[model samples]
Target: MIKNEKIKATEVQLTGLNGEDLGIMSTRDALALAKQHKVDLICMSLMTSPPPCKLMGAGAAKQEKQQEKKKAAKTPDKRKVKEIRLNLQMEDHDRETKQSQAERILTKGDSVKLVIQVHGAKEGTAGKEWAEQLCKSLAEYGSKTTGIQVSGKQVVVQLDPIE
Candidate 1:
């Protein structure tokens, strides 16, 4: 958007600040007309024959563009990966609560990760097996994205929704 004396074109199709066409004119005259309206002479299309130039406030044009960008960010994507944490010694009721929460998350077409952390010295096969059983019960909602895996003190399971 070269302006005024900075425009290399000898002549251009000129449009007034109020969007009225002033026809094709020399760059010098276009600058004079733009100055009369207290706006900048902007070269809009440099590639066209007799490039089109318009008289507009650069700040206003930039501000409008920024506002358009902001509007695009307001939309939301519902797909997400949610986590449900469990402990090796969690009570049965607490496990039921987490299962219900996972159901809700999957109902929204999202995925869930079930994590179980063993706290006591008995950080062995028992904790991982329990966590696997919980994950398997959720098969009514969807299939497991991965096989249950066990670390030294934690177990992780991933499930994706049917959709």
Candidate 2:
């Protein structure tokens, strides 16, 4: 998390709230001065050789920071991944429907996971090829993050984030 408020220091060469130079003093003395004027002691810069700070409204400053965080979180970034499943013998119509759903999810800035199940005898002969074909078709909808992998009787592939 990042802080957005410019804090005021207690003492030192008091750069006024608006950046005016007010000379030096102790943190306690500066805080007292700000208190007399009804303000907060904000530490703006503490990394200098002697450390520098500022003064502001603690509550208002915190609220403004929270608002900025909320705004940033609301801005969509295309890095989240969503998952979908398919069976080895899934009908063409069903596969198409699932692909449509995947497209919707990807359009909203999400990656997709295509999971295929290979059951019993279906796991033999051309099961692996079938899985590969399913992965290929899905890749047409979105970039491939991970190629198909067979684990026991299931195949899994991850889709890259949609552009």
Candidate 3:
């Protein structure tokens, strides 16, 4: 439906083709006026005692309404999660690259998940320390906008949006 489709006032005020008021009249008179103008009698408001309506080209009005609906539907909501993965033993260059990727994702209005997976016997104290260092580096380089948490063998960091 058109935005604020309802018309206000009891005098059955009509609007011209350029949206100027065409004065008040009875329902029958308005219908006759619409017929004379070769347009449709559209009931815009039913709140008043006699209700208020409009006289306009039905096809053009419907097309405008559909266009507005499509415009509203195309707008994107901002609260969506986007995920990125990393390994516990990722090299300095690879970690930097992944961090850049996460930054890009956050810039696009998405939350990023930085996952670090640990494997085998190498998943010892050194591995944990390495994970912590990586997390710290990511936080420092990414301006600490990310939320970090540890879950067993995985170190997950959620990157916040830029401003």
Candidate 4:
């Protein structure tokens, strides 16, 4: 936006800092008025007849409008598969707490992958069983999104939030 001599329009529709109209006047006169108001004369829309202008300063409302525009452009996180690992030795309460955490993640429209990692000789079979049990318990919050799979000592189960 141009101020004073920089403005091409001979006359402009002036709006005060408080959003009050200051009537149509020459760009120079509008600039003088803005000077009196201790603000900058900014031409808002210049293509139309008698271009519209505003009195702006450090407290210009345009700043807030720009801030709001920036805020509106933000987007929510895109859906991604989240992982929640479990221990074969976890107590019942610990297992329930982890399942609750998975529920919270599912509620946000993200898939949850439950992994039971064990370090013992029976961990392969035992981990898969534990993973299956966790998926069954999570039925109220979500549905199994993927089949449980066992790889080495780890068993994985994925669940999606109910639509």
In candidate 4, what are the lDDT values of residues 29-60, reduced to their tens digit?
88888789788888777679899988888456
lDDT of 4: 0.83
TM-scores for all predictions: 0.51, 0.62, 0.49, 0.50
lDDT of each: 0.82, 0.66, 0.63, 0.83
* Steric clash count of candidate 4: 0
Highest lDDT, which number? 4
Ranking by TM-score: 2, 1, 4, 3
Error of 3 at 155 (Å): 3.6
> Number of clashing residue pairs in every model?
0, 10, 0, 0
Tens-digit lDDT track of model 2 for 28-61? 6776777886766555456663345455567865
Alpha-carbon RMSD, candidate 1: 6.9
Q: Which ten residues in a row have the lowest lDDT in candidate 1?
A: 119-128
Instruction: Flag regions of model 2 displaced more than 4 Å.
Output: 1-16, 19-26, 43-52, 77-80, 120-128
Error of 3 at 49 (Å): 12
Summed over model 3, clashes come to: 0
Residue pairs whose backbone atoms clash in candidate 2: 7-42, 7-54, 8-42, 8-53, 8-54, 8-55, 9-53, 9-54, 12-24, 13-23
> Which residue pairs show collisions in model 1?
none
- Report the number of the highest-TM-score candidate: 2
Candidate 3 C-alpha error for residue 30, in Å:
6.6
